[model samples]
Target: MTQSPSPTLPGSRAQTLASAESLVSAYEKAGYTRAHPGILQLAEPFLDLSGEDIRARMFLTSGRSGEELCLRPDFTIPVSRDYLTSEVAGRPHGYCYLGPVFRDRGALPGEFLQAGIESFGRSDKAAADAETLALGLEATAHFGMDTPDIRMGDVGLFVAMVRALDLAPAWKQRLIKDFSRKASLAQDLDRLSLATANGRPDYQGVLAALTGSDPKAAHALITDLLSIAGISAVGGRSIGEIADRFLEQSALDASATLPPYTRSLIERFFSISSDPLEASATMRSLAHDAGIVLTPTLDLFDARNAEIARRGIDLKRITFSSSFGRGMDYYTGFVFELRDGTGEEPLVAGGRYDDLLTRLGAPEPIPAVGFSVWIERLAGGAS
Candidate 1:
């Protein structure tokens, strides 16, 4: 069974509820219609789109028919799923939600209130991105956090850099998949730079033998070997999965070493972290120096900054770190977190996730962006 938060003092609970209501009211007044996604949601979407961190933390259960279900871990996926099934699925719409999101936070409470807005089908990507960040700041202000620390990043910039590089399709996918995972991304960089199988598994000989061979034949050979060894499976991985891993390894083994210049360019790109405007200039200069085209992505970045400034938000207060990510796979563009001075956890966080609606089953891509306010965190800081 899933655990809920322990009972709080009535006064404290009431105050938190009031704060959530106030946030919901604020979002609604800003033109978002209230949305109440169900408490119990299908688990597969979260398992697929939220990445490993959320999958491990979700409180999963099986329905009567054996379908996997989970207490909603976050509002984004659930809200998107709802929108996909609603009449306004493909139309421009804004949704605001305030409710408990369940997750296993170790010593932290398993359940806590989250309030936020989701704006879907907005084609004006830059303006939408700025609006989302501006609203996130407003959420902090609502909790008396007048100037919360704003840390921002644009994953699209990293994606564009990787795309412009001369890499095999598999390597490009691997690098992009590892972007949200800092440690994994570092290991990838190290392996690419070293161009050696130094930290590889002991089965390097097998990978070497399979390198440059036909993938289907290689898979068949591995399956046959496993069968001959009377091993139908290893650990929890099936024969197909095991074969796929070997194929991936073989492909990696066959690839040429990444050129030192290319590696240096990637490293330089990841090293950028500064004021949004300054970061934009640095990125443009880096691209120009490297003879790569990143104009479209950088233009959007600058336009987003311009939009934010137009809203009267001080650009100097926003810190954009190229390597920073929210660790969620669905965020495709700008991401950010707002934190009070006293705590390490963010009181408000969000980003642009344009592909999520289509991933959830829309006919075509619909632009989406939003943020969530951690009511409990804000209330705790206020107290």
Candidate 2:
């Protein structure tokens, strides 16, 4: 027999019905349909997309037959699984889900309501990102909450910049994964420089250690140190290897810590006020000045900004902050979070995860992005 629900389970403020109604209604207005009670999905798929951080925070179990399972942590995976297995293919499918998602433990994580939308088979990536972001904003507005402070970032753009510098593949991957944590990233770069200088056995190992930062001085130091070490007939790490690491690390750090003019240019892109039209120009000008001439990544940013402008959304109300990273590995492009401006944690966050669908083994790649409003956070904010 299945375990019975506790009396308190039915009384969670996080499961409040009115909020559910409001969330579902906003999703409906955005063309998503109520997606039913939902199916339980394997935890590994969601963990794979969410990366190690979420994996560590999960509640997991095994069945009587010894099959591994996990309490459903979020709605996006199960919904995507349904779309992939059902007749929803060959046509666009927009779905909204509201139900209990289980996480291990937090302030209020035994069970919580999650409301979100996922559109599969969508071709217009930019429009899709904009529409999804708008839905979250509208939902916050519906709650009569203060206007949300919205900022956006591009993970793809960041990775593109890393790749363009011609850094080693091993080093590039490390930086991309650790870009969100500034201090950790810097330390990683420092260690990589030191290892390169010390004639470490594996260049790749040194590269991995250096993943957190892109600093020119560190790179130069590594090169000079390695050249001196190499002259003494040291270990496996070569003089060329040391110099390469130095130059790569230096260039990477230098780019991240751009000069004043370039920094100002990048800063202007982050200044997207409520006017989407003005924000689009800001992004275009900044990208142009970044000498991102050959990179379609910047072009994509401009296109998405233009789409937001075309939608007649007030960009001034939504700040186009360039540094606004969502800090998840799966977000490929157009990430944003909605905060209540009281200096509290973000109430909602969402972004495009085009690579995630393919990573999750969908029948075909689906360009999808959506946001989850932290129900507990919203409730606390309201109270």
TM-score of each: 0.90, 0.71
The parts of candidate 1 lying over 4 Å away from their true place are 1-9, 196-228, 232-235, 381-383
lDDT of 1: 0.86
Each prediction's whole-model lDDT (CA): 0.86, 0.64
Can you give the lDDT of residue 214 in candidate 2?
56
lDDT per residue as tens, model 2, 328-376: 6777778888887875567778887777777767656777777777766
User: Which candidate number would show the highest TM-score if scored against the true structure?
Assistant: 1
Worst 10 residues of 2 by lDDT: 254-263
How would you encode candidate 1's per-residue C-alpha lDDT over 141-171 as one tens digit per residue?
Answer: 8877789899999989999999999987667
Mark the 10 consecutive residues where model 1 has the least summed lDDT. Answer: 1-10
